[model samples]
Target: MNKSHKYKPLSFRTLFLILGLLFIFLLIADLLLGSVIVPLKQIYFSIFPSAETNETFRTIIVDFRFPKAFTAILTGMALSVSGLQMQTVFRNPLAGPYVLGISAGASLGVALFVLGFSSVISFGVVSITGAWSLATVAWIGSFLVMILVLYVSTHVNDVTTILILGMLFTSAVSAIVSILQYFSSESMLKAFVIWTMGSLGSVTNAQLTVMATAVFLGILLAFFKIKDLNAFLLGENYARSLGVKIVSSRVLIFASTSLLAGTVTAFCGPIGFIGIAVPHICRVIFRTSDHIILMPAVIITGSIVMLFSDIISQLPGMQTTLPINSVTAIIGIPVIVWMIVKNKKFDSV
Candidate 1:
C-alpha cells in the first residue's frame, strides 16, 4: 500500500476535502447536538440571519456552544501538531507534550498562579474570578522548560538522555505541585484539582481568539519545518550530510512545540494520550510515516476525536459536563494500546 501510496485512489487533496467536510459537520453537530436539543434549523438560520432563528436558539448557538466547540477544535489541532513535532524532533514514536514534562512545567506555573500569587493578594482583586492568571502562569512555565530542553538537547548526544531528563523534570514539577497543594487552602486545592482534570468549555470568545491564534502560528511554524523534519527521519548524521542545519532546526522546533504545548495546557489543562496516540493513529490508518500527509491526517483525526469527546462531555440531558481528559483517556487509551501491540514491528524500521 505504501509503495504506490503517493498515487492512491484518494490523494492528499481528497483526504483534505473529506476532513474539511467532517470539520464542518462536527462544528454544526457540536453547536446543535447538546443537551438543549436546539433545532438544526435554528443553528443554520442563526448564522444566516435571513433563514429564520429564534432569539433563544441564537443566544445558545452564538453565546455558548460556538465558543466551547471552537475551543475544542483548536485545542485538538494544537495538541496534535505539537505531538507530531515532538515525534519528529526526538525521533521517538512515544515522545509527546505531556511525556516530555512540558505539561508539568505548565502545571507548575498554574500551581504558582493559583496557589502562590493569588494567596498573597486580596482574592477579589486577583484572578480568583477567572482562569486567565492560571493560564498565563502555565504558558510562562512551559516556555521556560522548553528553553531548558532546547539547551540540553544541544548539549546531549543521546536522545534517550533528553527523554529521561524530561521525565525527571516532570517528576520534580509534580513534587513541587504536591508541596503547594499541602500548603494551600481547601478552596485553592479544589480549584487546582479541578483544573488538573481538564475542561474545554472554560475558554470564552476572547480566550478562543487567543488560543486560535497560538495554534495557527504554531501550525504554520510546524509546516515550515517539513523539509528539515523529513531530513531528520534519516537521523542527524544523514541530515547533516543533506546540509540540514541541526541547531537552527532544533531551536525553531523547540519554540513551536513550546507554544503549542504551553498554550493548550494553559487553556485546557494537561490533556494526555491525544498527543502520543494521534500521530501513531495516523501512521496506522494511513500506513505512511511521511510527515506531510501524517501532519494533516493527525490534525483532522485529532479534531474529530476531541469534538466527539466534547459531545460526550456534554452527554444528553446531563446537568454538567464531564472532564475532557477523562473522556479522551477513555477513548484514546485502548486504541493506543492496540496500536502499540499491532505495530511493534516498527522497532525494525
Candidate 2:
C-alpha cells in the first residue's frame, strides 16, 4: 500500500474563513463610511426593496458609489498582484509595477493620443480613430522593455543590477515624456497631468469591462505560474535545480504584469504606491510567506484598502470629490516608508 502524506499547513481553511469574514466587514464599512452618510437600511432596501423606498439612495449606491468602489477594487487587485509577481520574478523585494516602465508606457500612450488624436474631435462624440493604435504602442513599449530586461537577466546575474536597469528604463521614458509634454499644446499638457493623478471615477462601464478582461487574463497567468512562483522563493539556482524553466517563467511573469499594469494605466491612469504597498500589507496581515496564502490575501486586502481610499476621496460637504490617487498616496506612502526603513537586506539578488 502506498503511504500518502497530508499537507496540513496550519489549517488554511480556518485562516481563509477569517480573512473572508474580515473582507466582508471591510466591504460593509467602506460602503458606510464615505463622505455621504449612506444608511444601512437604504443599501439593504436598494438590494431588496419594498415597493416605494427611494431612488436617491438607489442612485447613490448603484450609480455613483458602486462604480467607484468596483473600480477601486479591481485597480487594487490588479496592481497588488502585479507587484507581487514582479517581486517574485525579479527576486527583489522593492520591485513594483512602475519599475518595469509599464506605467510610463501607458502614460506615453495617453500623451500621444491627447496630443495627436484630439485634433479629430467633432461636435459631441470625440473621435477614437486611434484606440487600438494607442494600446498597441503602449503594449509594444512594455514588451520591448521586458525583452531588454530578460536579455540582461541572462547576462547579468545580479538582481540589484536588474532592478536598477528597470529604474533606468522608467527614468528614460519619463525623460522622453517630458520632451513630449514640453513640445505639446498647453491643453494637451493639462490633460496629461490630470490623467497622471489617476481617477477610478473616470472609467465608463465599457472601459470597466475592458479593464476587467485584462485583469482576468493577468490573474489566469498568475494562477498558471503558481507552482513556479512557489519554487522561486529560493533563488534562481535553487529554482533551476527543481526543474523550473527560469527564462520562460520570467517571461510569463513579465507579460502578465505588463497586461495588468498596462490595462490599469490605460483605463485609470498611473496609480502609485498600491503596487509597492499592498504586498507588504498582505505579508503583515497574513503572517505567511507562502505564495498560496499570500496571493489571495493580497488580492482581498488590496481591494479593501482601495475601497477605503475611495471613500476618503469623497469627503463630506465637498460635492467635488478628492483625487483618488491623492487618497492612496496619503495612506500608502507612510507604510511604504516604514517598510523601507525596517528592511535591512534590500540589495539581495
Candidate No. with top TM-score = 1
Show model 1 residue runs off by greater than 4 Å.
Answer: 1-9, 50-52, 119-136, 345-349
lDDT of 2 by residue, 197-237 (tens): 88888666656666677788888898888889878888789
Clashing pairs in 1: none
Q: Tell how far residue 194 is off in model 2, in angstroms.
A: 1.5
Candidate 2: 10-residue stretch with minimal lDDT: 120-129
- List lDDT for all candidates, in order: 0.79, 0.74
TM-score for each predicted model, relative to the true structure? 0.89, 0.86
Q: Evaluate residue 157 in candidate 1 and report its C-alpha lDDT on the 0 to 100 scale.
A: 75
Best by lDDT: 1
Compute the lDDT of residue 346 as modeled in candidate 1.
40
